[model samples]
Target: MNTTDALEAFALTWTGDLTYDVAPSLSCHEVDTLATLLRALGYTAAADAWITKHSRNDDEGDAHYVTPAAALREQLADASDRTPWVELREEEPDAFAAGHMVLHAGGRNRFAITEQCDRPSDDPDRT
Candidate 1:
């Protein structure tokens, strides 16, 4: 299969697997790659949706924590049933993440979940 087909097949494999909570935290590079691949595959809507989902807020500043809203959180929690290896990481300040739900999935580090917020509670209380 060609690159585009391969990507589509791969994406299809993770159909139900793609969700807010179980999503992966993508770096700037990963986002670019994903967007490019999606567009190349003619999945423009999907690409746009993915980017919009992961986009960060303009006023979020350089560093901040993000979390999903109630409805999305509920969906994510449900999605975790199939993909149990999901993780929610507080990304370091970077070019991506417009204060959205940063997810790490399919062994990839770049993917965004929508309905996010900037709040101190969004971070892990490791301290």
Candidate 2:
């Protein structure tokens, strides 16, 4: 299959697994956007809907956490069951996380990644 086709199919496999409480693998901007969306949806707190939402707001500058609102926590947990951001790490122990710190110098680390797949085969004779 073509690379795009394969990727689409693989994505379809998980898109159908929409578990509620799970958090999405969001970028920094996306975390912000989710807060905005949740706000629009009547979910309270930027902390409420920010799944991968995190920051160093602590006075010591060492604090980091994502506090989905109490109402949304169950939904987020359901989402975790569906898409499960944490599952990628469990399945991919050797996957390159880049840098040694939990969060890079910029304080950003991917909160989720979809299940890994074999590299697209380029050798016509091999597959």
User: For each candidate, what is the lDDT?
Assistant: 0.50, 0.38
My TM-score estimates for the predictions, one after another, are 0.36, 0.23
Off by over 4 Å in 2: 1-24, 45-127
Top candidate when judged by lDDT against the true structure? 1
Q: Write the per-residue lDDT of candidate 1 for residues 1-127, one digit (tens) a residue.
A: 8976777796655333352322246544555567676677776755654544444321233122233253355445445544767655434246344445555564555566543335464577422
Quantify how close model 2 is to the true structure by its C-alpha RMSD in Å: 20.5
lDDT of 2 by residue, 1-127 (tens): 9976664564444233331233344444545655565455444443343443333221223223423232234443445555633222222234444321111112234343232224444544331
Q: How close is candidate 1 to the true structure, as a TM-score?
A: 0.36
lDDT of 1 at 29: 50
